[model samples]
Target: MTFQDYFPIWDKLDPRQQNQITSRLVFRTVQKGAVLHSGSLDCTGLLLVKTGQLRAYILSDEGREITIYRLFDRDLCLFSAACILRSIQFEVTIEAEKETALWIIPVEAYQSVMAESAPVANYTSELMASRFSEVMWLMEQIMWKSLDKRLAAFLLEETAIEGTRQLKLTHETIANHLGSHREVMTRMLRYFQSEGMVKLSRGMVEILDAAKLEGLRDGL
Candidate 1:
C-alpha cells in the first residue's frame, strides 16, 4: 500500500504540501528482536508500522519485562507523544516482534506537515484520542476483571480480529499482555483446555468452543 493508503491525512493534503511531505519520508526495516527505541532514548517523531508487529514494554523493579501495548501492522508507535512534543526522553522500550518495515519522519518534518495542513493536525489529534481511549479501556479491563474472564475476553477479541478461532499467541505473550504472571496464565490456559474451551498446540492456542468462552464472560 502507498503511504496515503496508510495515512489518510495525506490524501487530504494539496498537491504541493503532499509532494513536500512525501519527499521527506524515509523507510527503515527492523529485524526481528531489534530494539526500535529504549526507555532512556530521546523521543522523536512517531514510528509508523507498515508491516509486522512490535511490542512496547518496560522493565519492572524486579527486572521483569512488563508489556504495555502491542502494535500490529498499520499501527503507529507513539509511546511518548508528550515527550516528543516537549522534546524529552522516552520511558518505554519498543521492540520488533518480527522483521518489520517502518516509516520514520523527523519531528521537524512532522511539524512542517502539521503546520501546512489543518486537516493533518486534526487527524493526528483524533489518532491520539483513540490511543488514549484504548489505554483507558485496557486499564479498566485489568482492574475489574478476573483472570479467567480476562483470558476469555482476550480470546474472543482476538478471534474476531483474526477472523478465526486459532490464535498464534504464546502463554508468555498472553501473560505480558494481560499484565499477569506466566505461571498464572499457564494455569488459566490449562483450566480452559480441560473444560474443552480451548486447545493448546505447538506455540499456538485454538478456541474449540467460542460459545462456551463467551458464556464464561457472563459469569465475570
Candidate 2:
C-alpha cells in the first residue's frame, strides 16, 4: 500500500500539499527491537506503519520502562515527530516491536502541509488528542489497578493482538509493558499458574482458561 492508503487526509490535501509530502516521504524497513526514535530531541518525523508493530513507551528516572501504547498496521504515530508538536515536553521512545515496514514523513514536509491545510491540522490535533487519552488511561490503570488485574488484562490483550492463546513473550517483556518488576511479574504468573489460569514455560505463556483470566481481570 502507498502512503495515500495509510494517510486518512490524503483526499483533502491539495495537489501542492500532496506533492510536498510525496517528495519527502521515506520508506524503511526496521527489524524487531530497533529504536526508531528516542527522547524528545530526536524528532524522527511522522511514522506511518505499513506492516508490523511499534511500541511507544516512557522510561523512569530509575531506568524502569512502561509502554504507553502500541501501533499496528495502518496506524499513524505523531509522537515520533515531537519537534513538530511544540506542546509535547516529555520524552517518548518509539521502537519496532516486530519487523516493520513503514513510511517516515519528514517533519518539515508535514509541518508545511499542516500549516497550510486545515484538514491536515485538524487531523493532527485529533491524533494528538487520541494519544494523550491513551496515556491518561494508562496512568489511571497504573494508579488504581492492582498488578494481578493489570497482568491478567495485559495477557488477554496480547492474545487478541497476536490471535493466539500461546504468547511468545518473556516475563521481563511483559513486565516492561505493564511497568512492573520482572520478579513481581514472575510471582504474579506463578500465582496465576497455581490457579490454573495459565501455563508458563521458557519464553512462553499459554492461557489455559481465558474465561477465568477475563474474570480475574474484571475482579470476579
Candidate 3:
C-alpha cells in the first residue's frame, strides 16, 4: 500500500496538498540498532512507521538515557521533525529497536504544506500534543514512582509487547531504559529473584508470577 493509505490525515488534505506530500515522501529502511534521528543535531523529517519498532529517548549531559515513547507499525512520529515545530529545544534520540521500514516526509515539503493548509497544521498540532502527553506521563512515572514499582511495570509491559514471559534483556539494558544505573537495577532484580517473582538467567528474565507483579505495580 502507498503512504497515502498509511497516513491518517492524508484523506483530510486537499488534492493538491496530497499530491505535494506524495511527491516528496520517501521510503526507507534501517537495521536494528540504527539511529534514525538525533534530535536538533540532525533535524530529520517526520516518520511514519511501516513495520518494526522505534524507541524515542533523551540523553542527558552526563550520558544517561531514558525512553520517552516507542513507535510501532502505522505509528507517526513528530519529534524527528522537530525543526518544523521551532519551540522544541531538547535533544531526543530515535533508534531502531527492530529492523524497520518507514516513510519520511521531508520537512521542506511538509512545512510548505502546513504553511498553506490549516487542516495539516491542526493535525500536526494534535500529533505534537499526543507525543508530549506521553513524555509527561513518563516524567511522572520517573518522578513519583519508586524504582521497584517501575521495574515491575516495565517487566509486565515487555511481557505483553513480546508476548512471552521470558524477556531477553540484561540488567544494563533495563537500567538504560529506566534511566538508572546498572548496579541499582541489579539490586532490584536480585530482590525480585529472591521473592520468586522472576527467574533471572544470563541476559534474560522470566516472569513467574503475573499477579504478584501486577500487585507490585499497583503498590500493594
Candidate 4:
C-alpha cells in the first residue's frame, strides 16, 4: 500500500501540501537486523511500515539496549523522525527485526505541510502523544516491576507476537531487551525451569505452563 493508504489523513491536506509530501515519499526495503537509523544526529525521517517488523530501542552509554517499542505491519513510527520536534532530546535506534518494506517521508517535507495544514499538525501531535505514553509505561515497568514478572510478560508477549509457544531466543537476547545481565536472565530462566514454567534448551525456550506464566505476570 502507498502512503495515501497508510495515512488516513492524506486527503485532508491541500493540493500544494499533498504534492510536496508525495514528492518526498521514498520506498525502501531493508533486510532483517539492518539498522535503519542510528544515533541522535541521524534525522532519518518518518518511517511507515508496509510489512514485517521494526524495533525501536534505546542504547545506554555502556552498550546495554532496551526496546522502547516495536512497529509491526501498518504501524507508523514517529520517533524515527523526531528531529522535527524541538522538545525531544533522546534519540532511538530503529532496526528491522524481520525483512521489511517501508516508506520514508522526509522531515522537511512533512514539517512544511504540518506548518500549513491544521490536520497534519494535529495528527502529528496525536502520534507524538501516543508514543510518549508508551515511553512512560515502559518507565513504570522498569522502575517498579520485578525481573521475573517482566520476563514472564516478555515471554508471553513474544509468544503472541511470534504466534508460538516455542521462542527461539537466547538468554543474552532476552537480557538485552530487559537491560539486565545474561547471568541474571540465565538464573531466572533456571528458576522458571525448576518451577516447571518453561523448558530451556540451548537458544530456545519452550513454555510448559501458560497459566503459571500469566499468573506470574499478573502478580498472582
The window of 10 residues in a row where model 2 has the poorest summed lDDT is 82-91
lDDT of 1 by residue, 1-220 (tens): 8777776566688888777767888788989989877765555457888998788776667656666677887787666333554554436778888899988766666777788688978877787778668767777876887889988988998898678888998998788767778889999999999999999987799999999999998782
Candidate 4 is scored at a TM of: 0.96
Candidate 3 clashes between residue pairs 3 or more apart in a chain or in different chains? none
> lDDT per residue, candidate 4, 147-180, as tens digits?
8999999999999999999999999989988888
For candidate 2, the TM-score is: 0.99
Candidate achieving higher TM-score, 2 or 4: 2
> Which 10 consecutive positions of candidate 1 have the poorest summed lDDT?
81-90
1-220 per-residue lDDT for model 2 (tens digits): 6789889889999898999999999999999999999998999999999999999999988888999999999999999998997876869999999999999999999999999899999999899899999999999999999999999999999999999999999999999998878999999999999999999999999999999999988999
Assess the local accuracy of residue 5 in candidate 1 as a C-alpha lDDT between 0 and 100.
78
Please name the candidate that would achieve the greatest TM-score relative to the true structure.
Answer: 2
Once fitted onto the true fold, the runs of candidate 1 whose alpha carbons sit more than 4 angstroms away are: 58-60, 63-69, 80-82, 87-90
* Local accuracy by lDDT, each model: 0.78, 0.94, 0.91, 0.90
TM-score of each: 0.82, 0.99, 0.97, 0.96
Which stretches in model 4 have alpha-carbon errors above 4 Å? none
Clashing pairs in 4: none
